[model samples]
Target: MITKEALERVRGWFAGRLPEDWRAAPADITVDREEITVRLTIPDVDLPADTAEAEADEARAGRAKAFREETREQRMKIAQEAQHRYERKVSWGVSVGGREELWTHVSAPVMTRLRQPQRLVLDTLVEAGVARSRSEALAWCVRLVGQHEDEWLGELREAMGHVADVRRKGPAA
Candidate 1:
């Protein structure tokens, strides 16, 4: 978590310094690797600003992107300068969707409707000392399948990607 003071400082930095594009240049502050990352989120300048309507009840979504390849030179320079001035590591970034969804370890209740046979299988695992409970057994079984059929799963994911691409292109005439 970024400190409130640090967050405010970044806001103040943009408000005071950055030329010509302050209000429009939205930003975020995060603490990572013991450094204060001052990310200046530049909007899609590619979008037609002079569009007729406000594009109400809709958001302008670019590609599901991660770690943008390009950014305004000035923003980066200013961030680096701030890093030097504050004697703290300050980094800048301009991304479309920003960060990727990296998974974190989680232990949460999950609701599932298993077939009677599948439920019996889970109970069998517990009885055989393979798992502590039905849920644990089910999870263990999934992991076993995932480990054995990694490549097959990868191919299935690739197929899903193609399906998504086709869907995005819309139905044929």
Candidate 2:
């Protein structure tokens, strides 16, 4: 499990390395065991007041795409350095005009053994066409749980963080 202090260090490192002009504010960094995701919010594109909603959206998407292309090399370099230092894959994303796009993110396969009941639930989702396969169904279920129980999960994570801190302060084994 990643400690709060380690997460903060990752955030601080990105904050120092990222160019000020690249993001309107500091990057939003999230780290898990396998990867670190860095999301930067760029300045909104300027459009005519009379621009149609669809046109405005297209413009925003274009801006995001252009930024992605323009900064590809720099982003790659930074990601390489971060991956080496953190020993995890690095994913990049950009948010522009209320839209967010993630590119080059890792999709790691997870292995688990499910009991009959759990397997049935996943099969039901596949039969209903909610997901294409057992893996997809399981992922869908996990995402649903995350969305619905976000607050509870957040509190649980905080408690776990506190526990980790206490353990760290205890004598070494």
Which candidate gets the maximum lDDT versus the true structure?
2
lDDT agreement of model 1 with the native = 0.58
Determine the backbone clash count of candidate 2: 0
All candidates' TM-scores? 0.39, 0.93
How many steric overlaps are in each model, in order? 0, 0
CA lDDT, every model vs. true structure: 0.58, 0.94
Q: For model 1, how does the per-residue alpha-carbon lDDT over 49-130 read when each residue is reduced to its tens digit?
A: 6654344112223221322333345656876787676655655544432322211112446699988998999999999999
Q: Residue-wise lDDT of candidate 2 within 68-173, one digit each (tens)? A: 9999999999999999999999999999989889998889899999999999999999999999999999999999999999999999999999999999999999
